[model samples]
Target: MKKLLFLVFALGSSCFLFAQDETVQALKKDAERTIQKDPNDTTSKTWKTGGFVGINAAQGSLSNWAAGGDKFSLAVNGNLSLYAFHKKNKHTWDNTLDINLGYINTTSLGSRKNDDRIDLLSKYGYAIGPKWNVGALFNFRSQLFKGYAYDDDGNRTFNSNFFSPAYVLLSPGVEWKPNNEFSAFISPATVRWTIVKNDSLAAVGAYGVDPGKHSRTEFGAFASLNYMKEINKMFSYKSRMDLYSNYLKNPKNIDVYWTNMINMKLTKFLTLTYSLDLIYDDDVKLFGENNDSPATQIKSMLGLGFLVKF
Candidate 1:
């Protein structure tokens, strides 16, 4: 249902965008006007929309090279981030969607998914003060393709897939938004759903769901912080942190997720991006010598690609 909602909203946004015949020159003029306006004025722009799309690819062929490497290798990665924000008459609505997908093919390892992610966030707030608001926040995250890990015997164990495991979180809370670039939201009443729809996975109780159930619900206290800073036209940074503590279960065992991204525009069309993500869930156990123990998860990526902005 969360995924359905996201797709519906995404489709509506796309139709709305195409319905307007906005030109590149007009957008440039609008950008010029935006630059001239008071940067700190939150109400200066009633509707704001933009996004970045990038693609990176690499290929290598080795012919008896001295350095040991795969005979043939290729990698391709693509990412998109879109945001739409509206602020008027003490009411604000913000929505964002981010997707990343990658694949690698090598003579030794075969083709596999190196990265995959789908994330959506939406929030609506009614102001109570200059920097405080009553709001409801919703977020959904999952992946796109099947994931597996290979062992010495060349047997692959299924780990994840599209919607095989997903997370949906919703909270009605107070938000402290000091400026357009920063916000913190917290609430004691929060509901989170951990979903594992695949029958094979649910049979084994993957992702903390019951052995025969497709989903698990948790009532918890949740807090999140989001911030973005642009040092200059060429450099920018964004980060988000989320924390949750289940009141019905181990209340002291908290779940933490933090992610950061840095972007650099080297030229009109050239760009570089770096992303880091860290996650720790008390209910998730690692697949290792001690499968019962949980461990921190970390992922990082760096890319040089051609970028298009709108």
Candidate 2:
């Protein structure tokens, strides 16, 4: 009878252990699912950061082709962009910095700059309504290196250098953001400054600064529209346009800057990109094939490249 009781007790203990093991396994899976559903627990993410780097290249060689072209030509370009966004409660902040620099070598022109750009934008906002906010915006733009204009004879004339024609803008504004992909900011009170740090360029009154002076200031009204969207899994686009009218000077003449970029993903690390940039500044002069006046400046680039995103 004692043996029988011992056997029964052992059987009961084994069943209890098996049941406990099953319960533990079930709980483990449930905890994992809960963690997956709420990766950050009850708190929402407050900061997001991402950027991309791209490199593009092209080359051509001709030995006996009927078409007239350089015997050998090669171009390589690189671009980098970084962005950070923060949101908590009714406060939001966004920032972006972009840099582009590239070079080209050809039989005709040897080596020259193919691209140069630097842009920075920052904005902070407090929500006044669901889709509207009171905000402050800041922008800075310059170049990384000296740029030159080359004539047909391959003679070069200095055009711009680092900080030689830098621009700064600050504004307190109302911003309307209907969605994550679009925003419009308008400000009646804005300040703009233009700086030419190069003594030679400053002496020539380049970029509207007074001759021999290194800086120019203006009070203005400003407006800007920014848009970014991924059209599909393979395509994306971004654009921004800025307009400013100087209240202290010619209020009727407005300065404009617009930029657009499009990307088509060909593979995980390959992309085709196209970019367009336009600027119109009343104080700046542009010489074109048929016009030497203050014409609208335009630039376009298209290439297939390797892209990395994070």
Candidate 3:
């Protein structure tokens, strides 16, 4: 449903962009002609729309090593992003709606599992000065496939064993681009409140009330910093960092996570990427006892990918 919503928006935007009148066409032609006279004298005068797609093959390790086989798993991921932008007079505005869908299936002969996830994102921003802008970020995620379980007696007791997890988040923040190559978003910290949650493990049998059964709100501050250096015209080096923290009120717990990614553009259509994710979770006391110790988990991935823009 979330994917379909974005597809509808993309189709509508395409139709709107191609349905421009003669007046709009004349203005665009004049603007193009004027810019052709002076290569350096470019001003905001029109609107444009575009999209991009990317695919990658990656390998990573799953924490806790479920299924008791191999800790490493192969992952294939893909993303689709669409944007519409307008430039008028001295101000420019850009709106991007993106959808990400990916699946990772792992197998070690007898032990196997599949994890599929989807994300829908929307961003809207307007330029205040040359490199200063403010934007809003909205995102949603849903888990499609979850595994099943059986009793110690080797009999199927529960027919539905897996739960679908989903989240809806809205973040309002400001972005500053000091130069054409460096940009960052900071302020109000984007707080992603969890509106929908379903976890089968938390709802089965006696341990059913463990914070994951129903809707619960998690508070977090979000920040993103990106730096890019252009190497020639089609290649560049990019680095991005994202931080999030969730404070659970009832459980009296705190969860902090950070993801850092570095990518080298091998060509106009390909990239080599490396990502590291670190998570720190505080001790959780359940029934007057903590299940596990307060520890840190690290996960990393390396992959080569292709990018396409339209």
Measured by lDDT, the strongest candidate is 2
| TM-score order of candidates, top first | 2, 1, 3
Ranking by lDDT: 2, 1, 3
Instruction: Give residue 98's error in model 2 in angstroms.
Output: 1.1
Q: Whole-model Cα lDDT per candidate?
A: 0.89, 0.92, 0.55
Clash count (model 3, backbone only): 0
In TM-score terms, candidate 3 sits at 0.52
- The candidate scoring highest on TM-score is 2
Ten consecutive residues with minimal summed lDDT in candidate 1? Answer: 34-43
For model 3 the local lDDT of residue 49 reads 85
Instruction: List TM-scores for all candidates, in order.
Output: 0.83, 0.87, 0.52
Clashes per candidate, residues 3 or more apart or on different chains:
0, 0, 0
Residue pairs in collision within model 3: none
Measured over all alpha carbons after superposition, the RMSD of each candidate to the real structure, in angstroms, is: 18.2, 3.9, 18.0
Q: Which ten residues in a row are the worst by lDDT in model 3? A: 283-292
